[model samples]
Target: MHQILLIRHGEAAKSPTDADPGLTPLGQRQAETLADDLDRQFPGGEGVRLVSSPKTRARQTAIPVAGRWQARVDEQHNVIEIPSPEGMPLAERGQWIRTLLKSRWDTLSPAQGNWREDITDYLLQLASTRDEGRFHTTLVFCHFMVINSVVAAIRNDLQVVQFYPDYASQTHLAIDDGKLHLVQLGQETNIGSLIQ
Candidate 1:
């Protein structure tokens, strides 16, 4: 089985001014701890691949783990935070996201539904293995919504807010027979500030 670890990026600076804010000081420490944990599990980073969202915080979070594993982080566009409406300010993004999470995916507007499908399909595509003999794992550093959406897809649950993934949390999945199965859900708590 190929393991997929959905890791949430560490806490980010919630600033309306900065469009893509980097991790906060505390977040840096969290990333280092996460790296240490990963190294302990897969010493020397053997049999592990690192992937990250194309966002400042997610990239930052992936750095130490990639460095330890001697692998580069493959940045993925689809693993990014859910997009807000055009011209939606950072401060107001949280409210919009909160509203979106309240409704089920089937009840969402066409565009929103398409966005969900795009993310789900991209993840399933990644959870693949052409070699049957080799077993490997991929660690994905991404945002809260990104993790939640994938978990929701695996469970076939329509509710977008399947669970809240805290910073550095890892959701474990196993891919076998061309299907992604949830092995574990990440540590979660209702965190405020949706733009994270």
Candidate 2:
């Protein structure tokens, strides 16, 4: 059996100055807390592999956990977030995001190419890796839409895949006999637990 843990990146800053905006202060703390919880759950980190989307928030979230597990983090472009073009007013941006949820297009090509290809390809790669017995446990840090897309593909449940989870939330699944058995979805990570 291969276990896959899907994680949403921690909170991002309000205004994205950089090409890929990183996690905010609260987001960083959230990542740290999640990392601690992960360590508690998987003590030795044996048979574990870490993979992340290339965005700053996802990369940042994976780095600490990967380091703690003494594992190298691999970036898979196919796991990246859906692309929204730059330079839009706040209200328009908000509307744009909503349209994105409805699977509306920013451009015919970017929406069709990146989102569709990434989701399908990533799932196929993950399934192949699982079949090869490369790792018993795998952690994937990616955006909400991308993560849900892959999960939806695995379970053949398109409706549930569109629902986005909160920051730092997790979903767990076990693939046994080449089928996905969902253990949990939308497991919230409490940053307050860490502070306490």
Candidate 3:
């Protein structure tokens, strides 16, 4: 079986209007603490692969863990946050995301549906491939919705939002015999803002 850890990115310093924002000070500290926790779980980061979404916050969240493991992080566009509609103003993105959170996967726009499919396919491909003597566990630093997407898919649920994953929270999954299974849900938080 292949193990996958889906880690939500740390809190962003700026609002969602900024397009791409780095982490807050507290978020950076959270990342550090997460690194320590992961180190205890997988000492020296042996037999592990590090991956991060291309977004700034996700990339920033992976820094400490990458440093701890002395490993290079592979930036993956497929694991990025859910896309906003074309021509949607940055200021309006928060409201859009809030609405999206209440939506079902079957109701997604064509682009959004495509995005979900791409991410799911990418993860399945990753899990099915074996690297001989290399990594067995993949640490993916990604966004809130991305984690939810994978979890919802695995559970065969249509909901757009499965569970609320907090900053630096880790959701575990296992893949075996070409199937995905949920090992554990991540730590959840009840937050008002989906774009925070």
- Measured by TM-score, how close is model 2 to the native structure? 0.77
Model 3 segments more than 4 A misplaced: none
Ranking by lDDT: 3, 1, 2
* Ten contiguous residues minimizing lDDT sum, candidate 3: 124-133
Between prediction 1 and prediction 3, which has the larger TM-score? 3
lDDT tens digits, residues 106-191, model 2? 33455545675666555445666534665777788888777666666666654423455778888887777666667888764443
Reference-based lDDT, each prediction? 0.82, 0.70, 0.88
Off by over 4 Å in 1: 127-135
- lDDT at residue 2 of model 3 (Cα atoms): 83
**lDDT-superior candidate, 1 or 2:** 1
**Tens-digit lDDT track for model 1 on 5-98?**
9999988998766878899998899999999999999898877778889999999999888877778888988788777776777778767877
In candidate 3, position 83 carries an lDDT of: 90
- Note each model's CA RMSD in angstroms: 2.0, 5.2, 1.2
All candidates: TM-score: 0.90, 0.77, 0.96
* Model 1 score (lDDT): 0.82
**Model 3, span 1-196: residue lDDT tens:** 7889999998887675589989999889989999999999999999999999999999999999899889999999999999989899989998888888898999988998899889878877776555735878989999999999899999899998899999999999987888778999999977742465
